[model samples]
Target chain A: MKRYNVGIVGATGLVGRKILEILVERDFPIQNLFLFASSRSHGKVITCGPYSVSVEGLNDDSFKDKHLDFVLFSAGKEASHHYAPLAAEAGAIVVDNSSCWRMDPDVPLVVAEVNPEDAFKHQGIIANPNCSTIQSVLPLKGILDKYGLDRVSYTTYQAVSGAGIKGIEDLKEQKQAHFPHHIHKNILPHIDAFDEDGYTFEEKKMIEETRKILHLPNLKVTATTVRVPIENTHAIAINASLSKPFELNELETVLEAYQGLQIIKPYPTSEMADGQDDVLIGRIRKDPTLPNSVHIWCVADNIRKGAATNTVQIAELFL
Target chain B: MKRYNVGIVGATGLVGRKILEILVERDFPIQNLFLFASSRSHGKVITCGPYSVSVEGLNDDSFKDKHLDFVLFSAGKEASHHYAPLAAEAGAIVVDNSSCWRMDPDVPLVVAEVNPEDAFKHQGIIANPNCSTIQSVLPLKGILDKYGLDRVSYTTYQAVSGAGIKGIEDLKEQKQAHFPHHIHKNILPHIDAFDEDGYTFEEKKMIEETRKILHLPNLKVTATTVRVPIENTHAIAINASLSKPFELNELETVLEAYQGLQIIKPYPTSEMADGQDDVLIGRIRKDPTLPNSVHIWCVADNIRKGAATNTVQIAELFL
Candidate 1:
């Protein structure tokens, strides 16, 4: 195995931290590691493989003249827009965990298991799909490959952590003060920033990314994205109307035998899917309204499969 | 105002308790009050209108002798199946909160604000739609009526209370133990029992009830229902594609002028909808894939609009 030099941009954020944890847990071959953060975190130290490395402040100079094998970018869109290209220009293949370049014509949106082959065609940068989209389509890919999909109608119960560390802190602070309002006990209707068009940024990603990744620009995709108080996993209730009729047994066979998709046979409960790495799928049945439509319940650790795990998996494919 | 004699079935459950509180708070004009429960709660006392009444054990004879004006059935389906007919046959109009009568051809599914007139023509019983369905459609009723609905794809983040008192207690117990699994921090895939067909009953209700209430037997409706750790509200992400092309302004106008739907237009966060009584609608926009499609985020206190509040409002129609 050839060990590679790696760096994580936005090292202090939620997804960045999880990527570090996963790299160590999965024991990926790492010859050298670097951590980058904003100016405020410049001198902080983080543990990586028996050594404590000081976090370097991010700037265009941070990537100047450095020969890096891979750079995992988990910062917000603005930072990625300003920094990802600099790192890529320095000969590092940037795997961005942001929406900055996802829909760009030149950038390839890759879900390792679903489209690892697409990585070889990346134009210096590869983009990870939205957390909700990543977890949602993982289970559907194999099924969709076998039976053509005409439309998808999905509702998401997304965790706050998908918005990063601040989101988690907001819910925690709200919970502790008994803030006269029940924060954790209620489901929030909003997730990310609301656009002038009224859909949150999160909902828009589901609409746009699903089409691009599936290579079906004309496929009907609609989403309602919401932020609930949960801190870890994101779950989706999918009512997929198919172009071809599929037997329940055939659908289960397709899901069960598929790689990267875990079928929780009887019915997938959130408690059962919590902390699991693979996309947990259950409650497969035919939709009565349409002749070939089917309904499925999907759950995945949003921080893992939705972000970190997918990034690491992409890195693995590069190796 | 004409005061109607009213009785409550399954008066010890969570929704049943909420109904009692709302009725008292609203000062509904009740000519007489009767509370019925199972044998386990027969001796319990519940106060109604400055009077303390003992709960009588439910039996065939419970409604056989009383000339009741109206009865609100909040018991489970089995109880409703056995007792709802008995009450109706005895000449007492029944507003059933259980799923038993919801899909019956003779019963009319009513959402007071959406289809209050449907209650007047009830053959014997008026059925309340599922909590998830009630909240999702209240905002869309006027829009769908004006523009016409082509299809609906909905996913629900339902509260544990929708499962009754035991479900709420289960999550509370799980949370107190600080069990490796934090109930509040996780999402559970299962909301109700899996039937032989593999679809949870809650998912089925979302599909069936929407069709019946909208009178769109052929309308494409797909639902994924999950039970979250929250105690009160149920939130849904609804992606509705309309039959006709309508602008965002027209949709907003329909929502703003619609009865029972409250538009939480700016930053419609869950924090805003908690403890509120009306169905909160926000995050409305056009679906990029289909020109006529629209996406919406809706939230409502499940124990209120989903159950108790709706039941009490039904009684108000008679008063």
Candidate 2:
């Protein structure tokens, strides 16, 4: 097997750690692997397969002379904005897991199953879609392939971890910071900051990312993003209005055939996706009043398929 | 002040307890008060204001000769089905909080804020609509009265208390049963058992109860109900297509004018309705794609505004 020097940025973060664990579990060929975190996490040691590497403090010199094949960035947007370019300019293919460059005309925003080929066309950087957006659009791509979507409305029950480690701790300790309310026994309709149009930044990202990934620049979509107390997975209740008429059986058949989409019966619950890699799609039915429309319930592990697994899948496109 | 003899069944359950608290808090005139519960909770004592009452064991004979002026039944369907009729036959006006009598033609499913007049036409029995339905319809009545409904759909983020005390305890202790999955950190799409048509019993109840409460017998409606881990209160994301195009300003004006609906802006959160008597409505915006359509987010104390508050209000209609 061929080998490559791979680097993981923001490695002490939740999604970052998952990336390390998954790379070992999936046996990705690696000759030399590097893990980078903020100065606060510098002394930590993380192990992957047979390799044990001490986390290094990420700064201007971290990627200066290291000839790396791929670097997966999971830090927040600011850190990625500051450091991702350095790794990319240093001749390393950077796969960023933030919203910073996702909408940049040149950065290819990819969900592996839906747009694997797009990852290969990336110019130095490839962006991963938002956690909720990734789970929703993964199954939606199959439907989109069959019939162009006319309008989509999403009500997302996103897990706490989608906000990263502090989000997980907040739920554990009954604290609130990035979220507007106590999330332990509550749900926050506000995710990200509110845009002037009353849509949260999180909602905006899902709407725009879905349109971009499906190659439907003109698709009408609106989303209400909410933060639920769940720790690992995110779920969405989606109503999609399709441009063409679709039979109930045809909707089921397309989802069943779609790679990385699991259509479970009696509906899909968030717990069912806690550690699962495939996005669970179920509760598939037709909207009573809308012609050519269907409703779907979807769930996936926010850290795995929504982030880590997808980041790794994008890296696999090169091999 | 006029007073009446009142008997409350299922006194130890969640909604039943809330009913007792509200009656005392609001100082509803009571000539005499009686508390009844199942055999297991029969001997328990509960306090209301300055009154202490022992729970009487409920049986076939409990309401046979009580001659009560009013009876509030919050027991499960079986108990309500067996005892509510007996109470009504004994000359007590029965206000049932179960699904048993909600769809009965002669029985009025009343939300005081929406249809207080309908309570008077009840043939000795009145029904409180499902907690989810009551909150949704309260604000919707303002719109329905102005412009007839074309089509409606609801996606609910219901708290565990909607499932009763055991459901609340399940989330509190991280236990699972009744709910398909663990409820501590997850969302269950299956609220009630499923019917052959794939809709949960809870979902069907919301659809039917809304039509009955709104007096829109032929209303086009559908619902997807999910259980979140919150301890109290339920939130809904509603999308309604109106019969005619509505000015956003006029829609807001009607909601503002509604008796028990609070039109809060930037969307309503579950925490906002934890102990509130009114249903908090917000996220009022025009649906970008559908003509004559709007999206509104609503939250209410499921135990209070949804059940106990409405049940007591029905009793007050006669007082």
Candidate 3:
């Protein structure tokens, strides 16, 4: 086994820290570990396994001397937009977790299990799908491959953690910070900024990304993303119209055999998916209303399988 | 104004208590108020604005001599099953809040604004739609009456109070007494008991009752109802494919003009809908995936508009 140099940007944020933890847990072959953060987190010492790294603010030459084999960027879109290209130019394979490069025709938007082959086509950068979209497409790929899909409708119950630390704090402290409204005991239909057509940016990410990942540019996709008060994991109610007719039992079996998708019993809940690495799927049933349509309840830890774990898995594709 | 005797069965339960409060808040014309409860709540004295009534255990003779003009039953199905017919046989019109008689052919299931005229045709017992269903059909009716519905899909974020006091306690104490799974800090895709077809009774209620209330027997309806940890209010994400093409602005205007439906600014959430009598509608947008289809986010106080308030409004139809 050959060890490689690994770097993590935004290392102090929620998803960033999870990335660091996952690297250690998976015992990835890492000869050197580098940590980067914003100016406020500079000089913060973080440890993983036998490695202790101090977070450094990104500079023009930050990645120049690193000889980094892989750089995982969990920073927001603005940071990723500024720093990801610089890191990629510095010769590191940047697996960016922001929405900046996802729809870029040159960049491959990858779900580790669903589209590992797409990772090889990356031009120094691989874009990780949105948290909700990552869990959704795993099952969708199975269905699309077997039955074919005509349309996809997503209604998401996203956890506060999807918004990072401040979102969790808002729920715990009962404050109306981070989120636009009180999220302690309330639900918000708005996730990201709204677009001109009334679909939020979060929804557009799911719609566009799903079509791209599935290699179905014309697949009709719509999403209504909502923020719930849960601390971790996300649950998506996926209603999809299949392109072909099939038995319900056959469809369940097909999903059961799909990689990275778990057919959990008694239906999957947010708590059940928390800390898990796989997309836990349950509540598989026919839509009854539409021809060859089905309803799938998909749950996954938004941080693990959705963000950090998927990023790490993308890096693993390199080895 | 003619005042009449009103009876509230299950007077000590959560919805029952809300019914008592709403009646007082609305200053419902009441010559005398009678309270009935299960054996556990017998002898408890509850006070309304100008009346204080002791809860009595339900007996065959409870409504025989009370001369109750209207009886509102919020007890669970078993209690409502045994007592509702008895009360109706005693010449009192029964408006049940349970699922006992919702699909009964002789019973008219009504949303006050959508189908109040059905109340007049009730043989004896009128049924209140399920909490999730009640909030759902308010907007569905608006859409159906305007553009005609081809297919309907519902995804619900129901509050714990829909399960009554025990559900709220389960969330507060982190107990799993009322629900099959832990609901505090968690989300459950399963609500009520599951039928053989994998749909929960709650989902079935939404599907079957929506068709009944809208008087569209052949309508295509599917639902995925989930229980979130919120204490009050329920929000539903409804996706419908309409028979006729609609201009988005024209559809909004039609929904705005619909009675008992409020086109609220920003998107309606559980917090905004709490204690509100009307179904709050928002996030109206075209479903870009399906032709002539649109998405509507509907929210309402599940206990009020969904249960007690709708029950009271149905009684007011006789006025």
Candidate 4:
């Protein structure tokens, strides 16, 4: 196996930390590693496989003259916008985990298992879809290719960690004090920062990223993103009104045939979705209200399929 | 105030215990009180206003020869079907919190604030809509009455308590143990036992009860019920595609004018919903994807508005 010298940008954030954890766990061959964060986090230590690396402030000179194989970017869009091109120009394949370039015509939005071949076609940077979109699409991609998808209507039960460390800390503090209020016992409608259009950034990402990845600009997609107190996985209740009808048994067969997907028939319980790499799917049945429509419940670890695993998978394809 | 003698059936169940809790907290005037449950829970001490009442084994003769004013039944449907009619025949008004009588033409399905007057037309028993349906409709009832609601598409992030004590205990046990698997971290598609039609009992209740309560049999209502690890509140992401267009400011005005709702605009955090009695509405916006559609986020304690408080309020109407 060819060893790659990889660097992780925004190594202090939740997703960034998870990327480091997954790379070590998955035994990704790394020749050397670099950690970059903001100025305040400079000199902080991040332990990867067998190396204790110190974080350095992100700067234009950070990637200027290094022989870098791939750079995994998990910072917010602004940082990715400013740094990803710089890393690419310095001779590194950039696998960005931000929404920055997902909808850009030139960037390939790749889910490794779904579209690993899309990696070779990337001009300089590849975009990882939003965490919610990545998990939902992983199971649907193969099925849609085989059966053809028409319309997708979904609502998400997302964890606070998707917002980064602040979200998880907010929920933790609220839980510890039994703060007259509770984050776990309630649901927050807004997932990310609000925009002028009223849709939270998270909701917009689901819409735009799904359209871009599926190559269905005109696909009928409606989403409502909500943040719950869950810490790991993101769950979705989806009602997909398809263009063609098939028996529930046949649909099950199609979903079961897909690799890296778990068919949690009987009923998809949250317990079933926890700690598993595969997307757990269940509650599969035909919608009684609409012809050719099917309803399914999907759950995946947001930190994995939504971030680290997908990023590492993209990096693996480059190797 | 005229005091009414009340009997609580299924006294040990989740909603049953909540019903007892609210009755004491609200200071409902009671002439005499009786607790009834299955033989398994018979003789269990249940604390009600200033007294620890022993639960009696339920039998056909439990309500016989007694002048009971109201009987709140939170028992399963089979139990409710067998005993509610018996209590009603014994001259007691039954406020059944089961689906058995919800669609019965002779039974009035009531939400006190939404349609208290409907209570006067009840023959012998009244039906309480499903918890998810109750919370969604209470806020919409006044708006629909004033603005005319054409359709609603709602997805619920339901609490485990909706299933009962066992469901709550299952999640708690799963959370306490650090197994190789993560039980509390994922979303569970199944809430209740599956029926012949493949829909969980909870999903069926949302579909049937919402139609009957709204008095719009043909109203376009689609529901995906998911059980999260939360213990109390049931939260919903509601998108109502109306026949008439309404501006965001005007719709906020309509929601603010309602009596039982608390608008948590700016950002509707999950912490805002815990332990609160009022339905928390926020993330209000116009649906940009469709014409004449609006979306809003709603949350309320499932034990209260979903079951107990509604049951107690119905009993209060007769008092």
Candidate 5:
């Protein structure tokens, strides 16, 4: 194996830390690992496998002269916008876990299992879709290829951690919240800023990104993104109107075949997906309400399959 | 004002406690209030408007000797089945918050704001629909009447209290759970046992009870019932296809005019409805994915409006 120099931007953050941990777990071919975060996390030491890398602040000089094999961006869109392209321009391929470059025509959105081919189409930078959408699309890919789909509607029960570390802490304490409501014992229907159409930005991502990844430009997608008080794992109740109908056994077979997917009977709960990288799908049933439509339930640990694991898998393709 | 004798069965339980609190809050016309519970809760003193009533154990003679004007039953199915009929036979009209009588042909399923007239048509016992159904129907009634709904689907975020005090304590204490999975920081899609059709009994109740309450006997209704980690309020994301397309403003106006329904713009969250009697509706928008369909977000305090308040309001109708 050829060891390559790797960098994890925003290393002190939640998703960033997960990416580091996963990189170590997978024993990636890394000659030297670099950790970058906002100035506040400077000098913070994070241990990854045999390497103890001290987090450094990202600046104009950080990506200027350094040549790296790959860099994973888990910072917010603002930071990703500022530094991801810099790393990509500076001889390193960037796998961004932000909404910054997701919809950009030049940046290919890649889900390792679902659309690995799209990774090759990337112009130095690849986008990882929203956690909710990533878990949802993995199971839908094989079925979408054979059965085809007309309309898909998602009602997401997202965890507080999807907002990142601050959100996780908000639930642990009672005083403040990253969410509008007190999230300890409540739910917030708003995920992101509301658009004029009344659909949220988070919802729009699930709709648009699902279509882009599936290579279905004309797919009709709608979503309601809600934040539940759970600490991890986002659950979605999906209703998809198919273009064709097949045996129930066939649908189960397709979903169960996903490498990181589990088809548990009765229904998938958030707890079952915690700390696991696999996306769990259950409560599979034919939607009697709509012709050619089915009700599917899917759950995934927002940090693992939704974020860190996906970026690491995308990087593995390069090795 | 007519002061009538009121009896609250299962007074020590979650919903029963809420019923007691609400009866005092609303200052209902109660000449005498009698409390009844299981053997374990007997001798507990509950203070009301002007009297402290000690809850007594239910026995064969509990309902046989008393000439009660009205009885509200929140005890389990078996208890309600045993004692409700006895109270009804002894000349008291019963409003039962149990599934045992909900689907009975003689029992009219009532949501006070939606179907007060159905309360009058009761053959001895009026059934309070499931907590989820009760909150959902309050907002749909006016819209269903004017627009004529085709298919309505509910995805519920039910609170722990929906399962009674044990479920609430399970979340609070981090101890034993009524659910198979830990209820704290998790979600359970299985609410009640699964029927042969793969739908949960809670989902079935929303489907059947909504159809019955709206008097749209053949209305297409489907539901995905999930128990979220919230302590109060069952929030639902409802998609209803209208038989006729009307102005969105007119739809909002009708929903806002419903007596106990409040149409909060942007979206209604679970925290906003806690301890309140009104069913909060928001996030009202047209769903382009489902033709002639509108997306609705509604939240109501499951113990208050979903159970106790609805039962109390039903009693107010007879007052």
Candidate 6:
């Protein structure tokens, strides 16, 4: 078996740490592991398999000495925007876990299960879709394939973990550090910054990245992204209008058969998807008002399937 | 002003307590207040207006000599089923907050602001719509009145208080006493019992009660009700398709002018609605995919506007 040297940018962050754990759990063939983060996390020691790697602060020349096969970036968009290109230019394929490169025409926004072929189309940078969008599109992809999707509307119950470490702390400490309001026992209907059209940036990502990943540029999509007080996992209520009619059982079968998905009978809650890799789907039913529309409840570990595990899966496609 | 004798059944429960607070807050014209509860709560003292009242256990002869003008029932359906009619027969008009009388053909389900006229048409018992339904209809009524509503879809972020005292305890103690699953730091997509068609009883209540309250019996409506870890407020994402196109500002004006509705611009979250009587409306935007359709975010204190305040408002109609 061939081994490769790999680098994880933003190693001390939530998604970055999960990437390290997943890489070890999946036993990715790595001859050398490099960890990089902001200066605040410099010298922090993180263990990966038999290697004890210290987090190094990223500089313009950080990736120059590392003969990296893959570099997973979970740093914020600013860090990715600054250093991801530098790492990519230094001869490594960058799998970015930020919104910076997602809509870039040259960058491939890849969900490993839904669009691995798109991963191969990457021009040195592969962008992972937003956590909520990642879980949503898996079920949507199956429906779009069999029934043909005309329109989709989403109402998300997103966990604090999606906002990163401070988000989790905000819920734990009952503080409003990362959110606009106290999220301990409240629900924030706003996720990312608002766009001029009243849609948040997070909603826009779900709308645009979903269209781009499905290769359906004009598929109609709208989203209401909300932050709930949960610690992990996000539950999205997806209402989609299909171009073709489908029986409830037929629709269930298609989703169950889809790769990287699970059907939890009756209903799926956030607890069911906590720490799970597969997107947990349940509450499948017809939207009686529309001719061929259905409502689906989807849940998944946002940090895993939504970020870390997805980026790792994308990197595994090359193996 | 003529003061009237008022009787309250289930005088110790969550909504029952809120009703007490609202009555005192509103300074309703009350001559004498009577409190009744199950045998477990018998002999408990409750202060109402200028009198200290003791809760009496309900029996066949409970209301025989009271000459009660109005009775509000917030007890469970079984208790309301047996006690409400007895009170009504004793010359008292009963306003029931249970599901038992909501769908009864003879009973009129009412949201105080939206359909006060129906309150007078009640023969003896008037029904209070479900907490979620009460808040949703206030805005939907505005839309239906201005631009005919063709279809409506709802995704609810409901608080634990909607489940009454036990539901609140479950979240505080990290237990699942009332809900089927753990709700602390979690989201449960299932609320109430599931029907054969996969809709929970709570979802059905939202769908049925909404149509009834709006007097649009043939209106197409669907709902997905989920329980979040919040303590007080319920927020709903309402997507409606209208029969006619609407300018954004025009729709805002219509909703703003609607009684009992408040437009909280940018966003209306659970915190914004907590402890408030008005239904807070926000995040109004066009659903770009569908013509003549828009999205609305609705939030309110489920215990207040959703239950207690609404029932009290109905009582005020007779005053």
For the second chain, the TM-scores of the candidates in order are 0.93, 0.97, 0.98, 0.93, 0.97, 0.98
lDDT of 1 by residue, A243-319 (tens): 78788888888888878788877655565655667888887878775558788878888889899999999988978
Task: Give each prediction's DockQ, rounded to 2 decimals.
Answer: 0.54, 0.68, 0.88, 0.53, 0.79, 0.87
C-alpha displacement of A145 in model 2, angstroms?
Answer: 2.0
Q: lDDT values of the candidates?
A: 0.80, 0.88, 0.92, 0.80, 0.88, 0.91
Residues A197-288, model 4: lDDT tens digits: 77877888888787777778887777888777777678887777666777888888888888778887576555555566788888787776
Candidate 4: true contacts recovered, fraction: 0.65
What is the C-alpha lDDT profile of model 1 across B152-193, one tens digit per residue? 877777777777776677677765342223456577656566
lDDT: which is higher, 1 or 2?
Answer: 2
* Model 2 regions lying over 4 Å from their true place: B247-250
CAPRI rating of model 6:
high
Q: Candidate 6: TM-score?
A: 0.99
RMSD of 2: 1.8
Evaluate model 4 with DockQ and give the value: 0.53
Q: How would you encode candidate 3's per-residue C-alpha lDDT over A162-243 as one tens digit per residue?
A: 9999999999999998998999989999999999999999999999999999999999899999999999999999999999
- Writing each residue's lDDT as its tens digit, candidate 2 over A135-178 gives 89876888888887889989989888988888988998888875
lDDT of 2 at A72: 93
Put down candidate 3 lDDT per residue, B1-319, tens digits, no spaces.
9998999999999999999999999888998899999777789889867778989988888998878999999998998999999999999899999999999999999998888888999988999999999888878888888789888888999999989999999999988899888999888988888999999988998889988999999988899999999999999999889999999999999999998899876687787889899899999999977779999999999999999999999998886
Writing each residue's lDDT as its tens digit, candidate 5 over B69-92 gives 999999989998888988998889
Q: Is candidate 1 or candidate 6 better by lDDT?
A: 6
Stronger candidate by TM-score (1 vs 4): 1
lDDT pick, better of 2 and 4: 2
> At residue A229, what lDDT does model 6 achieve?
92
The DockQ leader among the candidates is 3
Clashes of 5: 0
Interface RMSD of each: 2.7, 1.3, 0.8, 2.5, 1.0, 0.9
**Going through the candidates in order, what is the number of backbone clashes in each?**
6, 0, 0, 2, 0, 0
